[model samples]
Target: MRSSLIIIGFFASGVVLGLSGKLPNGFDFDKFGSYALYLLMFLAGLSIGSDKNSWSVLATHNYKIIWVPVTIIIGTLTGSALVSLILPSLTMKESMAVGAGFGYYSLSSVFITQLHSHSLGVTALLSNIFREVFTLLATPILVSYFGNLAGIASGGATAMDTTLPVISKYSGKSYAIIAVFSGIVLTILVPFLVTFILS
Candidate 1:
């Protein structure tokens, strides 16, 4: 929640800077952005790999439930592909990359910005952020109509942390396991998926 707001603020600040034409001259933004992207990816990997609990969460989970995240990914990518055919603004690769973000806006947007263009990165950021926000705001209605797992699916990569509390409240404590499991799996896949699609 707070992080989303902070990202929006940063994006808005960047837009303001660009509009003001105050960016420093003679600096290679492409080179700097590439380095920054590499650093962010490294740090993200380090943070996850260093956390023993992250692996433990996966290791201890029932393998049967793995299908949940798998299904989410398939559905997301499928929808993205279909949308690509409909919307001329995005190609199949671009749409797939955007969908690959799931709900991990920060990491995915950075990857897209580097691998694709800033415009596509902004689209990924908005779409992914909306995924999380929709889950947070509509969990109850989602769970009520579409069932408990619907909330989990809507939560996407945020199910494990940001949307977990709401999901727990509406979907019952039993489903929290599935939510966290799917969230972690999707979060882990975001960078790999985006890079793969963009490549």
Candidate 2:
């Protein structure tokens, strides 16, 4: 229900943007969108931060859960490598940088747009947007079957921050600990990973 509402809201905003011709003119959104993303990221940080016990559980658990993130990284690397291979001349670093954007669409789109030009920015933005949506929809099913680790990874990088509530909802209290840990680790890794892959 919340996801549906979010999707609806975005769709409505898209309509408004189209009708008003008020789409962001440059890499930056009008102040409102920019602030909203910042707030969202901050909220994610706050949510995860407030839950210290989750981290303790993660440390206590057999580190087997680590594989969940490892698989996610591997998937990311494989996708980046394949894209680079197909593009041939595109270096591994560049592909990985693109991959590191890792579905953190809003900021990635803004930065990529500003740095690389609008087209690549749009690609980054759209891919991140889709990844978020995909993760949102997939969370329940993944948690039910593949378990919390897989569910968290399904959100890819967004799991670090924005997707916690959803993960918590589906995966239960224990998942919160994992979610916080995942969020921090991924948040720290995203920029470096993207740079490493892209550069």
Instruction: Give the residue spans of candidate 1 off by over 4 A.
Output: none
lDDT of 1 at 18: 85
Q: After superposition, how far is residue 97 of candidate 2 from its true place, in Å?
A: 2.7
lDDT against the true structure, each candidate: 0.90, 0.67
**lDDT per residue, candidate 1, 1-199, as tens digits?**
9988998999899899989998788988889999998898898889889988678878975777898899999999999999999889789999999989988998888889999898998899999999999989999998889887988998889999999999999999999988888999899999889888888
How accurate locally is residue 107 in candidate 1, as Cα lDDT from 0 to 100? 87
Decoy 2 TM-score against native = 0.61
Q: What tens-digit string does per-residue lDDT give for candidate 2 at 5-105?
A: 57548756876877997666665554566577568657766765787754664575668667666677788778877887787655665566566676776
**For model 1, which pairs clash?**
none
RMSD in Å for all candidates: 1.1, 5.7
Candidate 2 regions exceeding 4 Å error are 1-67, 83-95
